[model samples]
Target: MSDEIGLILCPEARYNRSPIVLVENKLGVESWCVKFLLPYVHNKLLLYRQRKQWLDREALVDITCTLLLLNSDFTTAWNVRKELLQCGALNPERDLYLGKLALTKFPKSPETWIHRRWVLQQVLRECSPPSLDRKEQADSDLRDSAEKTRLSERLHRVLHDEMKVCADAAGRYPSNYNAWSHRIWVLQNMAQGNLKVLHDELSSMREWVSMHVSDHSGFHYRQFLLKALVRELSQSLHHHHAPWPSPGTSSPCSPSPDPQPAHHQANREATAAAPCPSPATPEDQSSVPAMPQLFHQEMELCTDLIQSFPGHETLWCHRRHVFYLWHHWRRDHNHHDGQGCGSESPQLNHTDAGLSSHPHTASPRGVGLDRVESRNGQAQEGQNAMEVDGVGIPDPCDTKRLKRGPPDPCPPALPSEHGFVASVLDGCLSPEQGCFALAYRKWLDSVIGQ
Candidate 1:
C-alpha cells in the first residue's frame, strides 16, 4: 500500500502520495490519506444516495463499503446499505462480515452494531419454522424433523460465528459497551432459553474477564447470564416438585392405601427405613445445580479478583452486583418458600491473601483509575433492564426488604450482604486503603445506608 516509486528525494508524504503502515496482517491508513480519502468516498456515496445519481448496484455497494469502513458512524451510508438489503441485492451473511470487519477497528461503533442487528434479524426470521405448534411438532414427519434439524444447525453456526465476532471486538476494546451489548442481544434473540449455550458463554467469559479484569461491560454480561440461569432453575424446580394440597381442605377424591401383600409391604418398609450409606452417594448429589452455590462461587470469584487487581472500580461494581443479587435472592426465597433452591454453599471468607489495603484515589470523586460505565444502558445496545436482556444490578439497600428481614418463620442462617462487605473491608487492605475501597465503603454507608 506504500506508494514509494516517485520519491521527492526525502521520501516524504505530499499532496498526491501518503504513507501506508502495515502491522501483522493489518493495514493502517495514515491520517494524511484519511483526511482526503474519507471525504471523497463519503461525499460520493452520499451524493449518489441523496440524488439517486448512481443506480448501478455494484458501484453503490463498493462505495458504501469504503465509506462505512472509513466512518461507520455515517448513518446515511448504513441506511443506503439497508436499502440495498431490502431490495435483496446484498446477502445478510456478507453484510454481517462487513460489520464484523468494521467492529475490529471500531468496536464501540453504535451505528455498525445497529446495522448488524437489523441484518441478523433478517437471518433469524428466515430460519424460524412456519406455523409449527406443539401438536404439529409432536407428530412431525421424518422429513419435517430433518428440515428442522438442518435449520437448527444453521442457526447454531451463525450464532457461533457471531459469538467469535463479539469476542474479538471485546478484546480489541476494553469495557466495550457496544460489543458486549450486542453479545447479550445475540443470546436473548438467537439462543433464548438454551441452557447449554448459556453455560458455554459463562465458561468462556471466565478466562476472558480474568485477563481483562477492568471490563465492566464483560462483568455486566456475566450478570445477565446469571439472571437467566436463576430464572430457568426457579421455573424448573417449581414444576418438578409442585406442592401438595393441605389435608384440612375438603377433597372430592378419596385417599386409599395400596392393597399390597404382607411380604411386599415388608420388603418396601425395609427399603424405606434404610438410610443413605454415605454423604457422597450418587442419589444425594442431585443433578439440579444449586442456585445459592452458584452465587457463592461468583462471590468467591469477585472477592479474589478484587484482591488480585486492587483499585479497579469494575471489580467493586461487580461485587456490589453479586451482593445485591444474593441479598435479593435470599429475600425472594423467604417470600416464596418452595422456590427452586439448592444446598447452600459456605460463605466466601476474605482470604487475607496478604492483600492489604493501599490507596490510588487520584481521580476526583475518589473513583480511582477505573473506566467509566454508562449506568443507564442505551436501548439500541439491547442493554435494557428487562428480564430477557437486563444487565442491571438492583439497589442493595432497598428498605422494604431491610425491615422484613428473613422469612415469616425463618430458615437456616446465611451471611447478610452487610456482613460480607464488612468482612472484605477488614480482611483485604485494598490500595493500603486506596480511594476505590474507601469510596466503596462510603457508598455503602452514605448512599446505600441512606
Candidate 2:
C-alpha cells in the first residue's frame, strides 16, 4: 500500500487525483504521494501536528473537500461554495463564486445577476414597505425605502447608484461590451417616467465620453445621448403646446389658479395683435387674454438650445417652424408692419426724426457701405470699392424674396443634395446657411447670373 501511494505521487505521474484516500486511510505514505500532496496539505498537517487531539476523523473531511475543489472536481466545488455562503461570507468574491457555479452548473443560469439584485430588492420588499405601517409611532426606526411611498424613489436611487459603479467599471475596462450593455439596460428600465431620469443620465454620460471622444465607445455613447435628447425635447414640446383652458372659465376642467406666465404686458400686446378665439362676457371680467409671447418664449428656448448644441439640426428646424408661425401670426391680424426688423412699413415714432436728420451714406453701385464711426458719433462709410456691390445687405425674408423672383427656377432640390444651395436647404447641413439660405441663394444667383 505504501509503495502504491508513492507511485501515485511520483513526479513523472502528474496525477491531479484526490490525495485524500491515502491520507484518509492510515497510509503507508509513499514518496509520490508526498510530492503531489505536500504543497496543499502542508498547512493542514502543521495545524494537526501542533494540536494532535483536534485532528480526529472529521478533520480529514475538510481536507478532502479542499482537495476536490483544487482538483476542479465541480460537485465538491459547489458544495464548498454553498457552505461558505451559508457561513455568512458576504465578500464580493463569494458572490462571484455563486455566479461561477450558476454559470457552469446551470448553464442557462438566471440566478447570477438575479442574486446580485436580490440584496437590493430584499431591502425594498421587506424593510421598506413595512416601515410605513409604524410611521405613526413616535420612535419608529423607519429609514431608506421602508415606506411604500418611498419605494419607487428608493429603487431609482439604487439603480442610479449601481449605474455609477458599472460606469466606473467600464472605464477601467473600456472595451468591455458587457459593461456598456448593462448601462443601456439600466436606462431602458428607468424609461418609465417619460425617461426623465434616463435623459439626465445620458446628459451626464456625455461628459464622461468627452474624454474618450476618439474611441468607438464614445461614438456609440453619442448616439445614445442624441436619441435621448430627441425624445425628451419632443415630449417637452408636446407639453408646451398642449391645449389649456382660458383663464376665468369657471368650468371644472379649467386648470387650478390659471397656469399661464405673468407677462401681462406681453399678453396685452398679443391680444391687441390677434383677437382671442375665446368668448368674453361682462360676468367674467377676470378673464385674461391669450398671449402670443408664450410662443416667443417657446421659440427662444428652442433657439438657445440650437445655439448651445450647434450640431443639433432638429432644433434649428424647430426654430424655423417657430419663426414661420410668428410671421403668419403677425400677418393674420394685418400687423405686417410690426416692430420686427422686416416690418413692411415703418412706424412714425420719435426715432424717425433722428433717423431722417442723419446723412444717408449709401454704398456705390456694387459696393456695400461698410460702417465707420464719425467724430459726431454717427455711422459713415469707411471704405469705397465697386467689388462690395451686393455684400453685407441682409437678405429679405424668404416669402418677400420669392415674390420678387420668377418662381424658383426649379422647385427646391431635396435636402440630401450636397451642392451649396442644397446644403442650405437641408437643416442637417450648415445652419448658418440654412437659417440664412435666402441671402446665400441671392448672392449665388447674382454671382452666377442664374
Top of the candidates by lDDT: 1
lDDT of 2: 0.37
**Candidate 2 lDDT, 116-213, residue by residue in tens:** 34343333333233323554554555543254345455555556655664565456555445445545544443333233454455456555644543
Q: Could you tell me how far off, in angstroms, the CA of residue 115 lies in candidate 1 after the best superposition?
A: 0.5
Q: lDDT of candidate 1?
A: 0.61
* Candidate number achieving the greatest TM-score relative to the actual structure: 1
- For model 1, the superposed segments whose C-alpha errors exceed 4 Å read 1-25, 28-32, 132-142, 239-288, 338-450
- Candidate 2, clashing residue pairs? 9-32, 9-33, 10-32, 128-145, 128-146, 366-389, 367-389
- Angstrom error at residue 122, model 2: 5.0
| lDDT (CA) per prediction | 0.61, 0.37
Q: What lDDT score goes with residue 377 in model 1?
A: 29
Candidate 1 residue-wise lDDT, 360-412, digit = tens: 21221111112122322243244334335444544444467588776321111
